[model samples]
Target: MHSIHNRLFLLFLSCMMALLIIGSYLYYRSTTEIIHDKIGDMAEKNISQTAGLFDLLLEGYDSVTKSLNSNYELLRLLELRDKETNPAASANMERSITNILGAAFYSREDIIGIHVVTHKGKLYNYEKRFAGVIDPGFTDTDWFKKLKDSSGEMVWMGLYDGSVINTMQKEAVFVFGRQLYDLDTYKKIGVVFIETDPKPIWAAMSNVTISPNSRVYIANNENRIIATTEKDGVETPSFSGLPRPDSDHVIVDKSTDQLIVAAKAELADWTVFGLTPKADINAQVVEARKYLLIVVLLLVVMSTALATLISRNIASPLKLLIRQMRQVEMGNFTGTVNVNSFEEINSLVSSFNRMVHRMDELIERITLASISEKNAELQALQSQVNPHFLYNTLDMIYWMLDERENDRLGRVILALSHMFRYSSDWQEASRTTLRQELDQMRHYLTIIENRLEGRVRTEIRIDDAWLDVMLPKMTIQPIIENAVKSGLEPLNRPGLLQVYTRTTQRELCIVIEDNGIGMDERTLTELQTALSDGSSAIRGNEGHVSAANGGTAGDRAVMKRRGIGLPNVHRRIVLMFGEQYGLRIESKEGAGTTVTIAMPLPSKGRKIDEHTDR
Candidate 1:
């Protein structure tokens, strides 16, 4: 590992050295190639710009020619003139032609001049110097001569100006002209012409820039080299550049051979070219490698330093911590953990000491609590009345009856038996199997029915599968008692009471509904108050009403008067299963009430609790 680390560092240095060497070469190549590539990209971008520019300029030129050619009204009057007979009338027609000419050039700054040539073998123009000429030798000027000679199709002359009569006003420019013919006669009437300046197109192409280093240029397909750049104006054919060698786009570098070129076609037989240097791409790659080598070296050096520091500072503290943890594992957290090497290690020791202190404080509290709890248990034991007192009292009564009054003894025995047996209340957590709660509820119901036999009707409906369900002790008996007491409220009129157990959505639902003197909202509210308060169960000696609703006394009482049941079974269920499976009370005044208790279905594999049926 040591040797490899040494070799790795050396390899790192050597690789960096090699990268520097290769990068130096690549950078050199990239830099030179970048210049060439830049020029080519510039040239290509310029080609596109130039093509767009050329089209825009062609639009202006075409509009000028169209404006002049489309004036068939002017052409119609001129074609009616008698050339030899009324020469003066021809001069008057020439003035209207000049007025129309000025309108064509109004927005077009690039059109140098415009003119019209009538087909009566008379050269009629807007200019005074060139007006009213009878070239009655019938077609001598090349523009007129060509229109009369052709089959009268629209004509576009490439680049010429001698087609006009005036010699000096014509500085040579591109010409666009077309013939006007009468539809019926198929006869040539006159020709319209417009001159276009190419500088407008060049001006539109001027802002072409491809890259910071790139150069942009355009060349005529016929061989005019018109190049524009960020630092240079339109390049003439005499500028230092290669001739466009027939190919649409091909890179050629005078400084170096690496090049990328793009070409676009412009209007009027013009081809635009863009040049890009190949070195720009290589330079970016080499620069990336140069950055990569720095990152690797920093990682190597930093890792070695961090690993050494971690071993010296962190590993020792961790070993000490492992030993301390073993003592804690052996059940000894009384001693202090020691660390002074680093802040984190010191923090761990401080935390360990604090935890040990907290445990000590907890142990002390627990010891005192255990003593208090024992005292409380002893006090509770003292408060419990001796069961032997009643047993002795009953024994005494039976003994007396055996001696003399046997009738009184039998009556006394029955009363004493019921007092202990029927009033036995179990704790909450003890589970009561469904069958057992039902039996207890049945016995309680029998007692209630006996009291209100002719007044009310009571029914119990239980599912067979639910018979084995285990619920908390005393969950149903209170409900049965409440149903009877509340449902048989008046001495005369009575209501129907129904108890049904079924399964709904994975829960056992114990629904107790009453059609009794269905409560008013106010009475129902009092019943609700009574059911909620366990303390409200015993109101000065009528007997204890187990809190059915599990609410405060007032809320329990409000529900108590109306609920027919305080929903105590609902509370016991939620206490056994979570709060999610709890009481849902839906009641309507003067109609009926449904107190639904939902409990979770126990898992099949759980062991049966010994106290389940209490």
Candidate 2:
């Protein structure tokens, strides 16, 4: 009893309110997730780049030490003994080694000092003073012990006070060293140390931090903080949770509101960590939520008023049109809707009436065409039992009788007569058992073999168990005829034709293969195309049947004329069984051609009776 406008207003308002609530929640959740993913990706990339820079720095210092290992003068000086007896030679050697160390120091700006400590309580230092044999107790230090235990590989020692070595530059420095060996003796001679300024590594670590309050630090495999951008924050950050070394690059801790991203450094088994506050990252989204709320409220009010006006004008005409549509759906195409509520609605009603009239005409035409095509196909199949095959066999038998009148001539004539009688009897049924079909094929082959006289050879290997399977009459014989005419007759050498049957649990396959001169790819494609279209072509006109079944021409010409047999067989198989059971042909130019007849196995419970309907 309610007017259309009142009902539409309430429905539209409720839908708009629900959509606004759901849309806002989805937008907020999706946007927040995207932002977090982007931030984490940025953090991982920055830390990886920073770790690469640290590796490059360490590699450069290690290269300098490698050059010193090959320096023969340095090796000779470390191997020197009896310096007291040969004081002049010793003094000259000391000056030579000092200059070699100075060249390495000037090669890179980051190298603060290079020191070599021999096992014999002697030291060679390259710094501001160039002190020779300055500290004899350096071998007892913990850094020296660790370097010796490194087994000749370079080892990184954490930051240490620089005042112990040189009082001029008192700031902390990063130290790394390796054990040196004599080139020829293969014995440990001394240890070489390279100390670099740690500012470059610290600078790279600081750039990955997102905010002032956020902390960035590097930790070793032992979970010890080796370096940090914020000294105090390393000891007393609000959150101290660390991810496992093998965990993903980023992790979120909801309890602490922190997003932690980590990357492994390439050189020292160290991990870089960037800790950021989630609240700071999502501050902009909180502000956007407030504006979204106001916009949703205004849209709901506007949509409700517009829906009421539109529904009132559309309701009456649509109701009349729907009533006529119901009648059409029930097969009454004569009814028409009569309404003039709006211009669009009036045009729609006019189009519906015309469409119903056209549909009725189309259905009647399709039904008549289908019935006519089926009847024509059946007629074409019946006409394929041509009498020309009998005339050709009889003519061959007459030539043999006039020449020698041998027993083979009589046998060929008997087989030819049997084949004609079997093919001509079409009143019994359209389908026959496989045993009858194979026996008919043997008759055809016997005539073909006698005429060719050792030029053609054939083999049949059908299983006795498959003899009772039902199929269209004279199906395989036509394919054999085509093979002999088109595939064998053109060859100069003796041709081989093989007929075989293969049975599976679900289907039966009859294969005809020939070692005759086969068709090329282009000719085979055209023949297949013609066969697929032949079913409709033969049914549409009577002249096509004559062209396919009657002609006085060569073997190829006769094949082109009798091509209807292949398609006629294929169509009969499809109509009786289904589209899935049909003929498939394969051919190559020089090798051969093979045609397969694929059909489903007959059910064991079904009897082969004289029933016409499959």
Best by lDDT: 2
lDDT of 2 at 240: 39
TM-score of each: 0.33, 0.43
lDDT, candidates in the order shown: 0.54, 0.69
| Per-residue C-alpha lDDT of model 1 across residues 18-135, encoded as one tens digit per residue | 7656765676567656744565565555555556666666665666665555567665665665343566876676667666777776657666556666654444444333433433
Point out where model 1 deviates above 4 Å.
1-16, 25-42, 82-84, 126-166, 169-172, 183-186, 205-270, 273-614
Task: Quote the lDDT for 253 in model 2.
Answer: 37
Compared with the true structure, what per-residue lDDT tens digits does model 2 show for residues 298-352?
A: 7766777667666766877777778888998898877778887789888998898
- Off-target runs (Cα >4 Å) in candidate 2 are 1-14, 81-89, 128-141, 161-164, 233-257, 283-614
